[model samples]
Target: MSHASPAPAGITRRQALSAGAALCAGAPASAARRKPNLLFIHTDQHFAGAIAAHGCADVHTPNIDRLIARGVTFHESYSANPVCCPARTAWYTGRCTSESGVVQNDRFPIEPAMPDLGQWFGARGYDALYAGKWHVTGRDFTPSFRVLSHGHGLGEHGDATVARAAREYLRSRRRTDKPFFLSLGFLQPHDICYWVFAHTEPLAALPYPDLARELPPLWPNHGFDAREPETFRKNWRMGRIRQNMERWEEWQWRYYRWSYYRHVEMVDAHIGTVLDALAESGHDRDTAIIFTADHGDGMGAHQLWQKMYFYEEAARVPFVVSWPGELEAGKQDRAHLVSGLDVAPTLCDLAGIEAPPDCRGRSLAPLLRRKPVEWRDYLVSEAATTGRMVRTAGHKFIKYQGDGTEQLFDMRADRGEMHNLAAEGSSAGVAADHRKLLKEWEAHLSPSPAGRLTGTWDG
Candidate 1:
């Protein structure tokens, strides 16, 4: 017996047109009438509470707010991992970070051959346009978009060039016969750059609020621990001294809040440009717009400046999905668990195409229409080394590798994750449930490659 032939190596214009024709014909009348276009706008290091609509009275993001007003705003949307490369790859492939073997920044590159969501969309007749930060490959590789325009200066914190290029892509896409998938990637808020002290720029000149920036309620300090490890204690002492000396412990807090808000404002401004162009092209109503971030920055929260932790500031991200008439406006989804991985599959499903069998995420179409489905009861997250986090409606359980370091918090009572119930509680059953989830997750962890190349790659 012979199997069906595989798809072409890369999505060609011919394949796109043929797929478009097939999709238009075989699809139901409503599906063929006007398939929703996808405007996937994402940023780096943005938190859930950073937006005004999400009870953040300070930061102003009107474009994002408009998207929320038109579609569902997932209050509890989270990243599978809170790091940069791994999280992005997971978002692209709809696979767990462990499966991708990209658990940290040092993992460097994700294989180009990895079946990515953009390629899937391109194969299905959606015109995928990628602009701004393209961190997926260690080097350049093929993107699903027919036109791959880059190196137009999408670098740094205060650059306006990338935003301009994104606007151009939107304007240029007006005449396409197919719906579009435009990815507007922004590099903001994530520019803490403090990890490399030598290369770090001063936080001077950035606008800061007058009020003292309150640290994350759950910020872990050495003094808070009864019996901290010697290594952790040493690091903590040094970190505190550096923070105190640089006044980074003080001024940087305000600076971070300032820069983060400004970056968000910058992203929103570009979004407005695109929105105006869409309106001009008469495609605003026909398009489905989604706004989210790859991951979040700690932004000095928990005494940590970046992600790779299970804290709310780093783990949770803002997610907004909008389509004018098909979706209910101004609605918030608090019950369903949405992951960054869900994006690609959801877009494919929305376009009336079957997501490849290997894709790990489910469609959010039902949730978008306010229809009921059996949403996940426990959402999982991963980070550096081997860490597992399970978040339910009211609690968050975290287990770090063999150190036996575990954390549990009643999210409803301690939204700040201030209290750790693992040390004190009669909830052995809850703890057991968390352990069961961990065991199941552990079963899924991909085995690390063995042998000589490990040492050289550990950088």
Candidate 2:
């Protein structure tokens, strides 16, 4: 319940050790094993294709790249729900949107039994601390986490404060006996929401004429398949931003992409702050850093602007894990399917603890430690209460509750997701197979009941 700011600078060495001992007292026998400190860093609306480490030359993210060099990057990572609240709820609770009861942002609360990362880890002897945005809707982060920063607003102004708080907390750590789990909730390129709103109307000329040549081009799938499901088409036209973006010239879309990349660069610098502090505190090797995002932005893919749909730009996210010498460095786990739910379970497994009750996620600890293990073949991500995506290694199938039309795409062949293979008779069986897999997957989740959600938090 105490604030998680750095302890007083003048505390005696004896005092620090005493505090550590107090925190470790009465923990289970396995808790004495000096678990790795967890630095859970996540950004908002961060596209999987935005980072320089992931073959993305659009943005320079040296800090994220640094973490990539330190460990493995999961090439196939998707958010549980491609939005702020539900995806974050899945991350913190290790449950899907239905189980978490957070189908949309703040419209409903999380199921009471579901413990967020702060509550779950704190109860198990970690110094569960938090900074920046805690967008899990109904949960108040203070009671469970020792708060470092509560600033929740645009990334342009508030992200630096979040970084500073994390850096200070890391710098203040003088002992490792009690492992700390510091969650850095950075609001970034999410600020691109502001960028989109400000530019809803067409511009007469480029804002900065000199920088026009420096702009990154639009994504290849700028024009989309109009043969999408009824629900998918409905979401595409729901927002004013979408309606206005329809009028955007090709150059304007390029300008929007350039702005989004710049916003990413902005947050990358803030991440560098926390990384610098971790190293300065001499805990780099002992801390496991997990970097990801709640969801991703459209960034002109399929001429879309923000999340809600099951497009790759919105659903796929960057998931990286680093623990220095203990894990493989500079590698990509491209074969396995992963979800936002795996994060909480992986951290628990790495810390030698059991996951939360009914946690419907498998640990990625085996994959990270390079041990042989069977893994899940597909991942399901929910959207707008009823929209669902079942993704396998080669193909992705999408459906909505009320819409009879479904869409399936060959993800391996078309990363842009331009083709809807479900309409073809040859691929109908493949789509049916995914539907079966989805039904089987849902049978396992004892979904927490809630009223259906229809609103959009697309920004």
Best by TM-score: 2
TM-score of each model, paired residue for residue: 0.80, 0.90
Candidate 2 whole-model C-alpha lDDT, 0 to 1: 0.80
> How would you encode candidate 1's per-residue C-alpha lDDT over 60-151 as one tens digit per residue?
88977877877888988888778777777777776666555566674545554566767877877777777666566353424455444453
Residue lDDT tens for model 2, 341-399? 88877888777777776565557777776555545667788886447788888999987
Clash pairs detected, candidate 1? 69-330
Model 2, residue 297: distance off in Å is 0.6
RMSD of each: 7.7, 9.5
Q: Which candidate has the top score in lDDT?
A: 2
Q: Report lDDT (Cα) of residue 165, candidate 1.
A: 65
In model 2, residue pairs whose N, Cα or C atoms come closer than 3 Å (at least 3 residues apart or on different chains), thus clashing, are none
Query: What is the Å distance of residue 123 in model 2 from its true position?
Result: 1.6
